[model samples]
Target: MNLESLVNLAGEAAVLATGGLLIGMAFGGFAQVSKFCLRSAVIEFSKGLLGSKVAVWLLTFSAAVVSTQAVIGFGSLDVTGARQLAARGSLSGSLIGGVMFGAGMILARGCASRLLVLSATGNLRALLSGLVLTIVAQASLRGALSPAREMLSELWTVQGGPSRNLLSLVDGVPQFGLWLGVAWLACALWLARRARIGYLIEASAVGVGLAVGAGWLFTYSVSQVSFAPVQVKSISFTGPSADTLMGLINSPSLTLGFDTGLVPGVFAGSLLAALITREWKVQGFHDGPSMWRYLIGAALMGFGGMLAGGCAVGAGVTGGAIFALTAWMALAAMWIGAVITHLVVDGAVAGSVLAEPLVDQSSGR
Candidate 1:
């Protein structure tokens, strides 16, 4: 709050931001190259297609779990100490929020991270969606809509012992983490081996996992050194986006944090990749209908993400890494929501939304 305190906070934020920048760039480049969209993966799986992207996502999740837990086992990180991972979690919030976010991604035609990448690549539609997402998410977190989120979270919250992770529940059974990680890795390997772009997919999957796992380590390390109140978190777009936008007009106290750096880092990293790969293009709304759809969809995602405690990357990957029940349940709910949206909006019956051309354009080795 004072001048000296402000200077220290700024220095700490700068150091944390540097780490975030490196992680974001690595993730962005890989995401662009592999076209790793969570929405696309859900759609593809629902459509009965065993896609490589899904495999890559699973591999990343497994790797993150393995690496992060190893750190916890070695006393390097304390995820359970984080408020979000407290013993009590909101089941209803996760379900409702996941459903909303999943359906919204379908309507918006992309997830939060996808929009971030698209925005960096000069997509006007994504830019608008990003802005809406930031504003709405902020509202849900601390503004007018926060009451609704709190009510839902309180109504259905449940307690799960001293710690919510699988290891703790099972009394720190070492083999559980080992087997879970192995099973996931095995499935990912099988998927990668069967894909047309096997080698590329495998490499990208490993890179994404390393990036995510390393991000947790970096942030945790910074938290240790700062003596300031910095939360231990990894790659999550919803809160970070809102924090970045709000931090602009507010005091440094509001803006100086890990999420603040991460949101912009993702965009900057994606922009760098787009330029390097010559994929940057200025795209805009095709008409009024598209604009309206994006606005509604972004708002939905914003609300859902805040209520559920994270977006696709947040709950899906980061939360999943720690074997959190909330993450898995939310992910399942999101997938179901996406399926229903595809059926009603796309007018598809008992099939996936991923047609061949859509796959070609969105995903290619």
Candidate 2:
């Protein structure tokens, strides 16, 4: 399948691009309705509560994993959409980057993907965080910082792959998923709601959401024919962070990856949802110090996501949902980052910063 043939039959990259937008829209809607935040979810869970928000994350995962499993089992998934699914490289970024993104998410109020969803809901802090995230992503990809980042990764990487580490158990299903599901199940059991129509409906929706997201991402990733400089990508938060920044520009080419548009779609979807619910409002920090929090937090999330190679959805929920080993490592690091940030920064999960100049003492900033 040449690019020209793909262009004619699969509508070239048009279908792929649309699929990306759909992903953005689905998450955006989930964001608006659920107010989901992995950072907060972890915070609450650590504080002795399964709560509703955490379930949103689990329900989201349940939906994604079931859908992804269906896709792969049905011969519709390519298995290459996920970075660690079928690619080769040291899992350095997955582990280290996960910690970074996780911690930064705690500081920034949410992961990069969460920021996109929150920005739609009038959170000025998230909006500013998104900006910082974009700048750092570009810097990480290629800039003055690339050499150092690359060097550090080379120094610590070890040879590891997902060949038979856990296949001994099921000879199938991702190990990460198996463990995460166990945790999720435990939490779900504790939070068992009274049997009610509303509860069942919400649960079903969450399941559907997870299934659809994982299925689409996995399937579309396999469908990609553009394989020259690199393998096809499915769900990722780093490049999308850069692309989101590009869209903020006044003169971007408008002809880029679907990720470039997905962020905006998330925001737009959230904004519309908020408006219809009469919840839209222009809100923000109360002072310069608060603004500084937002800035530092956002920058941290971008850098962390880059280091982890994904964001909340890309890493925590998406990668974690799939039961990838790296996803598990990233989640651990993210939890560490979040806990440390909360204890060291200001005793606040959502660092109260937006657009003011950053404070230098913040974590990894």
Candidate 3:
């Protein structure tokens, strides 16, 4: 259906929400089948292994970059008004928040989107963590933690427009983003081939990327045709999760929009994928310590994601696709933070365990 027809029939908000639901479903299904998790990719890379996880992540990232850039290059989408580009941004918040989110994902064993996908597959740990994340995100957005988030965000701010656009910063580089995406796609394809990843998995990864691109395209299309003001945005879990949670709590006051449909759409899509693959199996925390770890991690992710203005997929893939400066910074910070945390927590623990026997001899154990 055309944008105008759909908008006329269901209203602009409903159309946007429907579009979000479809795009979110695609993302959910693709992510589920591909096992696309930035946290896993980070852990694998930190361990110095270029394995399937990294390959899958690269495929998704490259595909998202390529698809989004292609649309922009063809003049099919204009992201100048998107919040990632148009609004004032925070360098301090991106750096600190990205680091916190990365570390939290490691402790929680999943990122925001990953947690949602896992929760649908009967992971009680993920479900609880996701709920905690939503609550904390809501708190950070407008509740008890808003002041702190605002304070940190104000520490370092960048004006919107050209400054936020990384492509604009480069001089005389024509179609830079498209070319860069092409190069990345080539690399990803090579890695995927070398790793002998299944075709289905690779395709699913690409599908996830396409879904991101679709989100941008769909929203922009709606904004162009609708008389009502609609925000041109793509997929991002942080704000959407908080909004969705609040909508659930305040059903009478809920407003329909893209974000209003995204979370539930993703959940439903992931659930369907899991059921089809017979991967739906209930799982939960094994101990109190682990439960506490997840809770703390979820809280950190919630606040950090809100502070950063995006999560892993949000800033890393969606915003990165458009080459937003803060998004790239946040993405880099996430990788760095994940690597450092992995070394300190996982690596250090392993080292200590290995040294335990040597120390036991000195203690005559």
Best by lDDT: 3
Deviation in angstroms for 48 in model 1? 1.1
In model 2, the Cα lDDT at residue 295 comes to 65
lDDT by residue for model 1 over 1-365, one digit each (tens)? 63345436667777777678778877777777667777777767878888676787777777777777778777787776555576588889889999999988877778888888788888877888888998999999999999999999897876754545656678756657756877888887888788765676577666667677777887777777676767777888898888888887576565456666677777887788788888988877655655666787799999999888889888888888777778777878888887887666666432322211122224411
> Candidate 2 — what's its lDDT?
0.59
TM-score of each candidate?
Answer: 0.88, 0.79, 0.95
Model 2 regions lying over 4 Å from their true place: 1-10, 158-232, 247-252, 346-365
User: What's model 2's TM-score?
Assistant: 0.79
- Tens digit per residue, CA lDDT, model 3, 1-365: 77899898899999888888888998998899988989889887987888888999999999999999999889999999999999999999999999999988877778999999988898888899999999999999999999999999999999999999999977488779999999998888888888898899999999999999999999999999899898998999988998888887978766889987788889989899998988888776665555776787799899989988899999999999999999998898889887887677666775442111111110011
Q: What local distance difference test score does each model get? A: 0.76, 0.59, 0.86
> What local lDDT score does residue 66 receive in model 2, on the 0 to 100 scale?
57
Q: Candidate 3, clashing residue pairs?
A: none
* Candidate 1: C-alpha RMSD after superposition: 4.4
Of models 1 and 3, which has the larger TM-score? 3
Error of 3 at 203 (Å): 0.3
When summed lDDT is taken over every stretch of 10 residues in candidate 1, the lowest stretch is 352-361
